[model samples]
Target chain A: MKLQKPNDVMLQVSMRVITLFIFAFSFYLFLAGHNNPGGGFIGGLMTASAILVLYLAFDMKTITKAIPFSFTTMIGVGLLIAVATGIMSMLFGYPFLTHFFDYFLFPLFGEVELTTALFFDLGVYLVVVGAAMTIILAIAEDDK
Target chain B: MSNLVILPIIIPFIIGAVLIIFAKHHRLQRVISGFTAVGMLILTIYLAFLVYQDGNIVLEASNWPAPFGIVLVADMLATLMLLLTSIISTACLFFAFQTVSSDREKFYFYPFFFFLIVGVNGAFLTGDIFNLFVFFEVMLLSSYALIVHGGTKYQLRESFKYVIINVFASALFVVAVAWLYSVTGTLNMAHISQRVAELEQTGVINVIAILFFIVFASKGALFPLYFWLPRSYYGPPAAIAALFGGLLTKVGIYAIIRVFTLIFYHEPTFTHKGIIVTIAGFTMVLGVLGAVSQFDFKRILSYHIISQVGYMVMGLGIFTPLAVAGAVYYIVHHMIVKTALFLFAGATERITGTTDLRKMGGLIKTHPVLAWLFFISAISLAGIPPFSGFFSKFPIILAGFQEGQHVISGIALLVGLLTLFSMMKIFSYAFWGKQKHTSEQAKTPIGKLLLPIVPLVALTIILGIAAEPIFQYSLLVSEQIMDPSIYIESVLKE
Candidate 1:
């Protein structure tokens, strides 16, 4: 059986543009996650969906070149970072995952509070992206 | 000091994550995972000793005290389980080093292995009921992956059933937890126990109790729910099968013991005596009958797992301090002996190239050491005198007879005979009959495999000889478990 590819140039180009916008919005969600409803899980998922859209629009060779880092490494690093953040609390005689925050005036931005939870969120984001992408890519590759 | 309670869980999670990075380096992965397993064993032993000397240790995660946050608790029972888990995991990991294929190794097997440990240890130690469900998911997911590690046709097919059944049970688990929280307004196990004691056991609560029982019974492979065990367990390699046989179902039994003794004890007559005792009898008889009918070595062991589970539940059903102590002792004995038996079966399969009893014979002539070790474990499993099984079963049956539950006691005795009959059938057919395999095949080296089985066999013998002291310890554990006030006070103290 032959696989069908989307032949419409307009649909392909529009998907590419929409994928970029979704990627940007996902980053926005991740950045504002600590103070709002959006966080690592949803953001990472959005990022994966954007990549999926690219895969749908383009060929496997093109997308493989675009994402060079291995998914396994992403998952490993994400988990390590998350666990390390929790262990860091133990170093200060606090229980695991005890987050600390402090507010400081930035040069350009008005004020920013750096919280350990953001790093934890970042770890979750990476893991979500890595796991979802790995699964999607494997299934797609198997289908081909 | 209370922080020590979390180490068993954290160490594994960290090691598993790090192992994922070295997935391609088999030698590096083995060294790091080996070191981690031994380190965990040492830490678990120290934790058990601390609990023995100093009493329960409770750590509220992120300093959020008692009912409000996740907590890890290391009482005697929890520490004992942690110690046993580390022991079996270390043994199984070493065995896997020899047996598991290189492909499986490179596929993040070790990471999933440690992750499974994290789940088991977390389930054992968690003070909150909801976190227990979360830990169960962690364990189940890892298990689902590991069961299909090689992804053979048989593995993929059987693991589908295993996964589907467990997913259903997991959904039921969530519903049970939701109902319990709604009624008590607390997810912390210690807090819930306090609430349940105050309210006493109502009919609605009893319904919830049975619901929880059903969830755990499926996981524990009790009667009517054990249809998945024999077939699914047959697909994995021997090392993995041994680990699952030894540790997984026992977790379900541990949960049942913990919840029933601590939170749902107000109506023991209806729940424990009436329902549990009857189930215990049927589980024993049915399991042994299944074992007696199996012609394969691994399948026989699988069926025996169900039968042995019935004995432990019977001890719990009897519900005396002495009887619960016997159940505790039985768990320790069974975990060691069952893993040893499975390891022996693996060693035999390595030599004979088959698990069928009819196709294998006269192994004792060629591998006397392996055969003897298997013999010891077999007798111990069958409740023979002067072995670990006898001492464990003695108190439970004695307690049954003393309480005037003569029929259940008689059933226990009958099941013991049937268990011996099946075990002897394996011994005579596989070890003592005429040689069926070629001499070349029988000469296969099994030294590496026997290395793990020997320690477990020795432990069973030691447990039998030193039964008095161990029984005393179990008695103490039972006493602590029977009284919920002490557990609540220890966890909720301001």
Candidate 2:
């Protein structure tokens, strides 16, 4: 199905920024997700939407060249990262996925605790972005 | 310990990606994959023992503790399914080498095959329900590619419906998970079980349980939800079709058994014996009728997938240790035998160049090995004695009798008879009639193909001959599921 409306550079640029904003906001939400309201899934979808913005502005071949083979590989990497976080606790003699860590002083920031759960959430975020990109790109290419 | 729990899932992910780089070298790709599959088979056996020795082991992602982090648990059930999945995957991959056109192997087939295994193993091991949905999508996505790999018009048309229906089901799965999360506030199965037990209400829990049932039922191809299955499955090559026939829907049934028995047991009012048993009876009857009416060999086996699922669900719905044992036993036996039968269908397709029963015949005289193997699996599927199928079905039916559900027992017996009739129809039409294929078609060697089937046939025999120990183990698994307080306590820590 061809788009009925012609593309405008200004409109496309605005869509791009909106998509980028959603992606950034989603990442912020994901980082705060464990204790606050947002999560890995919502954050991942936001990242995917950013790519969607690019696809809309340009044809698929350009988008494909821009991304290269990273999306597929990143999917594997993200899943491995998620699994690695689970295995980390086993190495520490905790039961599977046992979250343990401590608060520490930082250079730019005062004090905060870093937990394994955040790492797992980040893994989830990466996988979501990669998988969503793969799907959108594959479908878009098929359309072209 | 974590190696046993996580390696099988990880190995496939690694191998699948590696295969992508070797896309230009078809022979090298096939050889490397074959080695990896053998390695996986060994890993699966070793893992099964590790689980057997250590009991259920949980791996929490990113060191996040329960109720917070995603966890993967390898219990008796998970390991058993893993073992079965590896066996079926190895067989199907070898079968694919013989059948999958050279063009496809060079394409995305090998990578997706590994991806499919990654998804299956992930689904089996996942402790979080939401993670289960994610893995389910992974598996379904891979299957969508494999089904339409050949890109024939027939395949494209059918797979389009298949993809749309599954996409809809996946969306529904997310919606159901959202509802479930809202209700329980925890995605961990063990935590959900504990919380659900505290609030024991038939009103809302029942709604959530039924919502879950809807999601799995569609995926598992139960009764009214099975329309897309036969049409779409018939389009794939025999090997891929056999793999889907054996493994895909069973994963759905596995999830249902895991969730309903463990987490959602609070409300018998909605999911209890009444609702499930009714569905089981209808699923069995309708499935067999569909099989009886089909003139094609693959189509018959596809319908029988629904029928066999009914038996497993009946065991669950009965909600007794014996019945659940029967269900567990039935799942193992069906996985092996069903894959074998489907492969045999593929073999016949290779020899005769058709899957239509009417166009096939007299394989018994020419290829007695194929005939006998089909006979073993078919008769077993029909619930014949000493063939593993009988042992699996016998307990469930006996459990029905013991539970005083004589009516269901009778219906089950009737379904068994119809199953036998349908199998015999395939035998007589496809393998027993006068030779129907032309001379050129008959020249194809059935022996090379039989290599993939020999292990499954041996397993069916071994399972039957050693039914006592296997039956006892299944009983043990059933005991754990029925009382699941232990599972809950173990995961959640009293």
Candidate 3:
């Protein structure tokens, strides 16, 4: 039976397997961004690409039903997170966006290095995802 | 060193983001936005006072040193801009709260409004040229959203043109910034000023200066490049129109003044006297002519915004302490008076359901307050004596004649007469003709609508009456800005 003829059955099955791997890789990219080439913006794009693949494999209706959240509000939440991170520095009597870092011992991870830049990066990551998804989805769903 | 400089930018940014959550909740959005506006007003007033008393207040972002990391500088000029921004924005917010439909307000209007404020204030305060571009993007982004908020066919069409023009201008702005950076080997404006002074503005520098002028002129609605302004400004809601009319072009003029004075001052004969003044003359004459031809109230006000911008740049073109001071005073006066006139246009449109002056008549009999208030503001804008416009124009024209720039000065006076003529035409057509509206249409309650505009009208009158002190304050600001060393020292100081 040639499953690759016209319908998206095989493509859909493959996307299901590929989607999980993409999510893991994107998160890895986000985490490794502290010292490497990967960062929030690129990682967020990667995640958005994975989501785009899901929308491609399935129709918009199915994918949106599975993930029922407004991308516009997601952008707002992301921006709030980002601004709050900057204001945190202000609350600590430092200048705006003045990030600080220290290493603390953990049970299994030992003395893991952590920094405020990571949180800032997280906000950027969320915003990029939200923005990218919003634009892509809006264009795809446009009736005109 | 102070952290106060970024507060204006940050507060709006935070509130803008916060307001996005409550987009559907109209009353809450208005309440929060109103409080933010008032808070910003008080903060800027205090900040302006502080900057006036103490020299410049510089904020090094994230504990970064000056000339390396980004810095926000609140000098007298920046603070004065911030003060005007807060005042205009506060009034615009209340006007929007009263006049804007809930449908449009629900479409993330308050968020973008606050973001526009963030961008304007940020543009005023940033010490780095690149940061200025970022803030410009922020401003243009929000303005794009606000312009097309209602998604009308006309709004979409006009705003598309608006967005394209601004985007092209922004691309040129980026190129100019990159070119300036490569030549000076610095992105910090003060450092660029220092390097420019070192190089003494050679031929290459003059080219870059003209390129910068073209970019900013497009944004500020200068002659030959202001084709995209009037129609686009005529599309949006009057509250948004008033805000854009009052504030947006001034940001462009502010950038022009900042760069021309600080970085490009060494070759004023080539750049300022030769190029800017020539452009300013044409901008004034052509812009006023466009106003004369327009029969729509909003269209007239929109074209007038372009003409008034020419005056501000003309002040800068003269490059004297008093002339630049006149420009500053004119910026404030034009901002207040222009916003009020736009609101009056909105008031009449609300009462009559049309902006066509030919369709509107006998507003003087019905809406007496709006008619008289608009008349006062219109005459003030026409450079009538004992109003803000006369004082602001007097110094610039005086400086022009003193500097032997009789041609451009004469052009300015002619434009002023045409301005008065067109204004009187608006008065006659809209207020003195046959009463076209039904008596019930005339009874449309504009008392509450007029509330937000009263302050601005009063400001125009007060600015006129208190021109001496206001002119002196602007003189202080102009002296601080004209002398580049003060700004350079403040920003680059360890």
Give the number of the best model, judged by TM-score: 1
Off by over 4 Å in 3: A1-6, A104-111
Tens digits of per-residue lDDT for model 3 on B402-472?
Answer: 99999999999999999999999999999888999999998899888888899998999999999999999
TM (chain A), candidate 2: 0.84
lDDT of 2 by residue, B396-488 (tens): 999899988788788899999999999999999988879998877777787889999999999999999999999999998888777878777
Cα lDDT listed for each candidate: 0.91, 0.86, 0.91
Off by over 4 Å in 2: A1-144, B1-3, B266-270
lDDT tens digits by residue: candidate 1, A1-144: 776765878868899889889999999999889888899999999998998888888888988898888887899899988888888988889887788999989999979988999889899999999999989887888963
* Candidate 1, superposed: residue stretches over 4 Å from native: A1-8
Per model, the share of native interface contacts recovered reads 0.63, 0.26, 0.70
Chain A structural similarity (TM-score) per candidate?
0.90, 0.84, 0.90
How close to the true structure is residue B164 of candidate 3, measured as C-alpha lDDT?
Answer: 98
Give DockQ per model, in order. Answer: 0.67, 0.23, 0.71
Whichever of 1 and 2 has more DockQ, that candidate is 1
Candidate 1, residues B1-494, lDDT tens digits: the string is 35678889989998998898889999999999999999999999999999899889988887887899988888898899999999999889998999898999999999999999999999999989999999999998999999988999999999999999999999999999989988999999999988887888897789889989999999999877888999899999998999999999999999999999989998989999988888888888999999999999999999999999999998998999989999999999999999988888888889998999999999999989888889999999999979999999999999999988899999999999998999999999999989888989877888878898888999999999999999999999889898877788889984
